[model samples]
Structures are given as structure tokens and as C-alpha cells.
Target: MIFLKLSYISQSRLTGLFSLVILWTLSTNTWAQKIIRAPYIQLAKSNSVLIRYRTDQATLSEISISTDGKTFNPSIKSTNKVSEHTVAVSSLQANTKYYYRIHINDQVALGDSSYFFKTAPTVGSKDKISIFSVGDMAAGETQRKIYNAYVNRQKSNYTNLFITMGDNIYCGGSDGCWQEDFFNPYHAGPLLRQTALFPSTGNHDYDNQAFPYQQDDSNMAYYQNFTLPSQGELGGIPSNSEAYYSYDYGNVHLVVLDSYAWGKDNFRIFDQENNIQLNWLKEDLKATKQDWKIIYFHFPVYTKGTYDSDVSGEIIKLRDYLTRVFDEYGVDLVMSGHSHVYERSRPLREQYGLSSEFSPEKNWPFNSSGRYDGSDKSCAYVFQNVEPKKKGTTYVVNGCGGQTAAHRFNWPHPVMEYSLDKRGGSMAIDIEDNRLDAKFIDEEGEVLDQFTIFKEVNKITKKTINAYDPIELKASWPGPANSYVWSSGEKSQKINLRPLKTSTYTVTDTQKCLQDSFEITVNPPLGTTKWEELIHQPFESLEIYDLLGRTWKSIQKEGFIDQSVMDGLPTGQYILEYRLKGKSYTLKLIH
Candidate 1:
């Protein structure tokens, strides 16, 4: 009996040992399914964020989010078999920190410490915003240096946005290059996983050799990997194409254009004649009531880098064409890359001619000194808040994020206030209220250049009056004022205007250097006898229906259209519907 019991014990021990080996093998296999490319965050909105990652093997992916850094809730899940996984977690709170983890096939791929992202503040909130801008990154050590420098200097929690000017990859924009040069440098580190990257497309991003203008198979990697605002869901016009888009953060309106692609194709912008982008841009700018407007793209309008703005036909064309649109729409700052140097211009206006023909009186209306002291006593430039016209805009070429190339021509452009090519760096912009402060920091965390743009707050009261009714506009300042100049060329604090039609008047304070604009909309009484002759604004739609609600005539047109349909209308009461600026109005008319 003792021998039998001993044999049973030995068999039991063997069974236990075999079970341990099986468990060990399973754990080793699970670890071997490592994530080739760790998860990164993108398109961080007020209530949503896109998480993307790649694994060595195709697996079901999921993400868990937690606000208290513990007790994570499974927010998003995808069952598709994909090595690359992208999932968007939505309905999150604004301006809140969220800790997240990646799980592939129910196994933890990445988790634990420091994996968190803060959602953007509520739109139009007065919260102070900080942004980092860099370009020509994703090379090697230099790119890492620039990124590290920015991360070291900036507060870990305060940074709200991160933007890349262009050239996100080096040599060729192939999948392999993106893996090694772009993703590994930014995503393999901690920056992109926390703060999303908003990138502009450079020539190198679309295949350096081919430089394909249109989005096709050559640039599929860029188009598929990065997602941007395109549906006008973020306070801009619907671009419908990810190549060019816009978004709003607080009171700042950011316009990102396809300067390299669209400019190279045909200098087509949203404001260009017959271009859809131009039309959308015009409407978008008109709709934006923000206090600050910033535009960024890949190519520099004014640069003295490897390519000369004056000599290069493409550069000159883009500069002249875009400057007009930017100035007309009151763009505050323009940021660009592709120059491989850092150049900041003074507040420039109407500098459409070549560099040799640039005139300070016409172009450099603001102080030519690159430095803008924020104090009221030493303020350099005071841009007006009026629409369709701004005093000036500051252009910055910050392409030295990854690589630096010596300027071929004279170091600085005529309007340049600061220029540097020796070191690579990034730009930090802090926007608060009506003031925008920008700093250029080198790889060593040194402030190489700094400037500020201040916009004086302007308040104008809008007035609506009936046609033939004279309207008097009285301009008053909160503080002591000296004189006022109206856009009608009147130098008076009180201007009496008799307008037969709608008009806009801008009044500028000659003493305080402040300006305000008011619009006078003259509309005739709803039911006037002037049916045969009616003045209509461009893009206005008109429709006429009988009392029975039967459609008699409909005209979807712009400008003046003769009321010829009135002649065919029966001699009875008819309803006239007019649509303009997204508002519809009904009027009772008799024929």
C-alpha cells in the first residue's frame, strides 16, 4: 500500500510540472505578438481623439480611457483583423485629462504611466492656448533634438496644439521612410502619443522625386495615415478634401492650405477666381468672427533660403496671389516651411512686387523694427479688426526644424526682421486675448527670436434702416480721443449718411490709432409697391409663390434680376421669398 501511494504522488507532481510548462509557453507567445509601432494620438477635438497603432500581427484592437487614471472604461473597439488599428473615442469632456491604454486581442499592448491626452478646451473659450510649430522634421538626430527641446521647455499640460509646417519625412515619402523617419521619431517617443500632430504636406511628403501635385497612389500613405478637419465641422468651410482644411481653437481661426500641391497645380486657392477652394475660403473667412486669424502651409511666400522668392517663378506667383487674398481677409500671421531656414518678417502689407521692387511705404506700413513691444507705449503695430482689409500680416518661414541649409542669396529678405540658418529649432506661439506672442527656440532650448502682434479691440454698433431713411452714425470712444476718419474720407466723430442701398463705413481714431467699422443695411418696407424693379445683392436667391402656395416663379441667381415674372403673375396677393446669407425672408407682394 505504501509503494502504490508513492507512485500516485510522483504522477501528480509530473502533471503539475507539465501544466507549468504549458502556461509558460502561452505567456511567451503572447509577448512575442509585440506592437511593432506603438499607439499615437491624432485629431484631438473638444470631445474626441483618434488613436492609431500597428502590431506585428493582425489582431482585434481596443482602447480604454479613464479620467481618474484608474478604472479604465473600454471606450472604443474594432473587431476587424488589421495589423494597423485606428479608433476614435468620442463624447469625452473638454479640457480634461484622459489616461488611455491599448489592448490587442484582449492582451495589454501598452499601458501604465504617462499615457494620457488632454482634450481641447470648449470652442471659443477664453482659456489661454499654447501651440508648437515645426517643419522639415523626421530626419534623424536633428529632428529628435528639436522635438526634445520643445518638450523640455514647454509645460507638459499647458500645450494645447502641435503643428508641423511640412516635410514630415525625409528623402522619399514611402511607407518605409515614414516608418523609420517620421513615425518612429515622433511616435516611438512620447510626444505624439500625448499631443496630436497637425501636419501640412510638403514636396518630399508626396515623393520627393515625383512631387505629385494631385492626391494619388504616390501619396496614399500621407492621405490615409493623417486625418484632418474637412467637413466644416470645426468652424470653417467644408473642404471635402483632407489636402486643405481649417479649424478653430478658442478665438483663433487657423487656415491650412495645400500651398505646395494646389499652388503647383495652378496657383489655385479657395479665393482664386472660379476655384471652389477660393469660394469656400471667402465664405469661411466671412463667417469667422474670431479675433485672430492664422494661416499655415508648406511653401514660403517670401524666403531667402535655397530657393529665392524673387527668382523662383512659382514662389513669386504664389506670393503675389496669396498675399492679396490674405491681406484682403485680414490674416494676422502666416507660417510656412520648405526654406530650411528661419525667417520672420515685419508686419507687411501690399508687398506684391519682386524683392527688388519692394517699397516700405506701400508694404511695410507698420514699424519695420522686427521687435513688437507689447506695452501700449512702445507698441509696434496695431492691426484693425475690420473686415475685408487689415493693416498688415507677419510671415514666418520656420523650416529649420530638422535640417538647415545656408541661404543661397542675401541672408534676409527686404521685409525680414529676423533670419537664422545655423541652427534648427521650432516655434512656440502663446495666444491670449488680443495679443499673440511667438518665440523661435533652437535645439539647445535658446530663444533665438521673439515677437508679438497686438490687435486693438474695436466695437461697432450695426444699424438697419428702411430705404430713403437717412441714418446718422455717431462714433464714440471709451477713452479720450482726438480725431476720427471714416472710410468715406470724412474726418468727423459724427457722420450723417443717406444711403439708397446697403453700405459699410470704417471709422478710425487718428489719435489712439484705434478703428471701428459699422454696416448700414437699407431694406425697403416688407410690402412696397416696387415689384418691377428690385435691387438684389450677389448670390441672393428669390422665389415667388401665389396665395394658394403654388410656385409661380423661382430664380436662383446673383446680382440684379429684372422682375419679369411679375408680368405673368395673376392680379392678386403673392408671397415673395428671398434668401441671403443663410436667412430666408418672406414678403407680401401684389401684382
Candidate 2:
């Protein structure tokens, strides 16, 4: 009986082991079936959002992206599987919430209820926002480790938007390499939690496509991963096929182009016979009019190291043809990377090199402005006229995001102003109505460099323009030493004071310089005071004055007594000092 029991136990153990093996085999098959893996995923940069991811296989049985955890529906047309089986999610609503999932054919592979994205707003949207961008990335355990620092910096800061200036991964750079090099590093970071990543293609991006060489591959990974805006003026390729695209943010418009496309068939960027990209660029530039315009690409036109100067074939061709266009319109700045260094050019053009107004003897016509303390910062020979001209666009190359290559500091561009090649860094562009400021920040979040691009409002050209006779006020009081006080209680940028009340306020400080008194008068709000009730000389108009004998302006039945004005004025000291009751009644105006 004991021997029979032992046999039964042994049989049970065999069955259990067999069941475990079957379970393991099924799990392994499921993992292999997934075409995409290590998805270093992100949304787009500007107003649009592009989703990027890498796959584990060359060709998948089937692949699709679906909203949240929903099943893929072919009729929706939202899913796209591109070259190398990579995918991009595009054409989403700006400043909104979205959920998504990935699928391999009909089998749902990765489903997370929390996978979400928010698109940026179009121009004039008036949305306060946050964004991020980095450049010069590569594959390595070191890059992987630094990536965590990047993710942490992003999570705890004001970077809601993300942009990558190519070189996202550095495996041998295939779809498989991107999985290992790019996505695997930060696949689980907060930056991925909720952010959009706008990526520009770099030289390393086209490493292994069917094209003859790296330059010829056309960045299949970049195109496959990000779904870019295709419908607007950025034409040349299919709407979705064109690597170049534009998106608006508040009052800013950003145009992203594939620099490698212009990088010459035989390593020559400027071929008159093959002007395909140049033509497309002209059309694209003529199409947009946001308050500020910024362009991003891989090869920089101005740099202090590596491929410096526009003479580097591609840079020269692009600069010669495109710089004029950017100036014709109001492009605020242009940004590029791939130098493994950081450099900034002064606002430049054919005429102005570096200094705007300061004219040096050598550069003859174009001289730096010598006006501001004679420091020679003006790139005057380029754009400055007797009157202020629309400023030239400044170009910046912030390529040191990550790379094994080092920089040699010999700058070549005549307009180049600042250059640095050190540890990795990033740039932050702060945009507002009046100005767009670019700040270069290092990995440690220390500000390495700073520059401001002041937006110049172009002259209004119209058949008939509405004009206002700027409210003018005149005051003449005692000598130069006399202290002069005016009403409205605020200091203005202009030296001459102008008041709309037609009344002037003047107070003399005997301890100050000379002051010449003029026909000064103060009037109360039309409704607040009865002008006819006040008695005065027949032809001489009556006037009112405050405690310091300054005219308090009043017009159109309203006076400057809002909280702002009242806050500074003394409450018990002010008076309705009008000659109504035969004499001026010193009435206290409450705060």
C-alpha cells in the first residue's frame, strides 16, 4: 500500500512540472510577438503632439495605436505603422487629455490606463504653458544614467513640453538600436508620465536605412516615431510623409525641418541642379505670421567648432537663401544642433556681421553699434538704419546634449558671439508678447549663458490709420532748484508729461532748481462739480488745486481716483479745493 502511494505522488510531481513548462513557453511567445519594445516615448513640441516608439522586430504581423485601452479599429484611421514598424500618434487636440495603448495586430500588447498626452495650443491661444528640449544624445550606459537625471529635472521643474534635436539613440541606430539606446533609459520616467517630445533628425538618425549612406537614409526612425503636422504650408512630401512641419504656440510659430535632407547627395549641401529643399523652404517661410517665429534643425549655420560657418556647404546654401527670407518676415531666431558644441551668433545678415550700430574700420559698412557706452555690440552694418530697422534673427547651436565627441574652440562665423564646448547642456526659450529670451542651461540646471531677443513691432501699413493726439499736459514752475510735482501721482518714461484733463499741475520745491510757472488749473469730474455754480473772474476760467498746489486732472465726468491712484494719494490731505462757497473748500478725499 505504501509503494502505491509513492508512485501516485511521483506522477503528480511530473504533471506539475509539465504544466509549469507550458506556462513558461506561452509567456515567452507572447513577449516575442510584440514588434515594438523599449519605447522611449513622448509627445510633440509645439502646438501639435507626435507620439514616438521603437519596435523589437523588423516587420510585425500587425500593429496599431488605440485610444486609452480601447481595441484598435481600422476605420478610425488613427493608427499608423511606418518604416521599421515604428509608430506615431498625430493630429490630436491641443491642451487636452488623451489616453492610448499599443497593439500588435489584433492582440493587445501594452495597455496602460494611465498612458496620456496633452497637445500644445495654436497661436493666439493665450495659454500659459511649460515645455522642454535637449540635444546631442547618444547610446551608452553613461547616457542612460544621465537620462535619469534629465527625467528628474523635468519632473520637478517647469518643463511641460519636450524637444529633442536628433541623436536620440546610439545603438548601431536601427529600430532595434533605438529600443536599446533611447527608450530603455527613460521608459519609466515622469517625463513620460505626461509630456510631448518634438524630435529633429540628426546625422546618426539615418544610420541604417536602405539609402546608400547615412546621409541618404532620410531618418526613417524620426519619421516613423513622430506623427507631425502635414496639412499646412510645409509641403514637398506627402502630408504625413513630409519630415518638415510647423505648429503654433500662443503667439509663437515653430517650424521644424530635416537638416539632413539638405546635407548633399555626395556630401554636398548646395547643388544648384538639385534645389528641392530650397524651393520648399521659400514656400514654407511665406506662409506663417505668429508674433514670434523660431526654426529648428540639425546642422547649424553658425558655430564655433566642428562644422562652423555657412561655407560648410549645407550651412552656406541654407543661410544664403533662407536668412533673407527670415529677415523679410519677422523670424525671431533659429536654433540648430549636431556640432557637439554650443554657439550663438549675433543678430546677423549680409551687411551686419556682429555689432549692429558700432562700425569698425575693417568691416566698413557693417559696424557694431558704438552708441551704448561705445562697447561695439551692434551688428549695425547688417540691418540698423538711421532709424531702427527690423532686427536680424539670432542663431544658436546647442548640440551638447550628449555625444562622445569633444569640441575644438576655433570659431569661424564672423557673426559668431558666444561658443562653449563642455559637459552636456540644454536651452530654454521663454516667450512673451514683448520678447523671447533664450537661456543656455547645463545639466546641473546652472545658467551657462543668456540672451534676449526683443520683438520689434513693424510699422502698421494701412490705407487709413487711426491716430490719437496723445494727451498732453504742460507745467511751468519756479527755478531749476524747485522740485516739480504733477498729478496722477505716477512717474512715466517720457520726460514731458501729458494729461487729458486740459488742466496742468505744478508744484515748486524752493530747495530745488529753477521752475517757471504757467497757466495751471485743476478741474473736478464733470458730474462731480457744477462749473457754473463756482464764482470766478468773468473771462478768467476757474481752476482747482490739491494740497501741494498741484492740479488734479478731471475730464469726461471721471477722475483718476481708482484704487491705484488713491493708494498713493493722502486721504485726509486731498481737498475739493474749488471756489464754490465763495472760497475754496478744503474737502478731504478718503482713500
**Highest TM-score: which candidate?**
1
Tell me the tens digit of each residue's lDDT in model 2 across 505-582. 433222222222333233442223333232232221232345454665332232322333333344343333323334
Model 2, runs deviating above 4 Å? 1-116, 141-160, 210-219, 233-240, 262-269, 351-390, 412-414, 456-524, 527-591
TM-score (C-alpha) between model 2 and the true structure: 0.59
lDDT of 2 at 37: 46
Name every residue pair that clashes in candidate 1: 270-277, 270-278, 271-278
Worst ten in a row by lDDT for model 2: 1-10
Query: TM-score of model 1 relative to the true fold?
Result: 0.69
What's the TM-score of every candidate structure?
0.69, 0.59
Q: Give per-residue CA lDDT, model 1, range 103-131, as digits (tens).
A: 76687779876788887777777567888
lDDT of each: 0.71, 0.48
For model 1, the run of ten residues with the poorest summed lDDT: 1-10
Q: After superposition, how far is residue 105 of candidate 2 from its true place, in Å?
A: 14
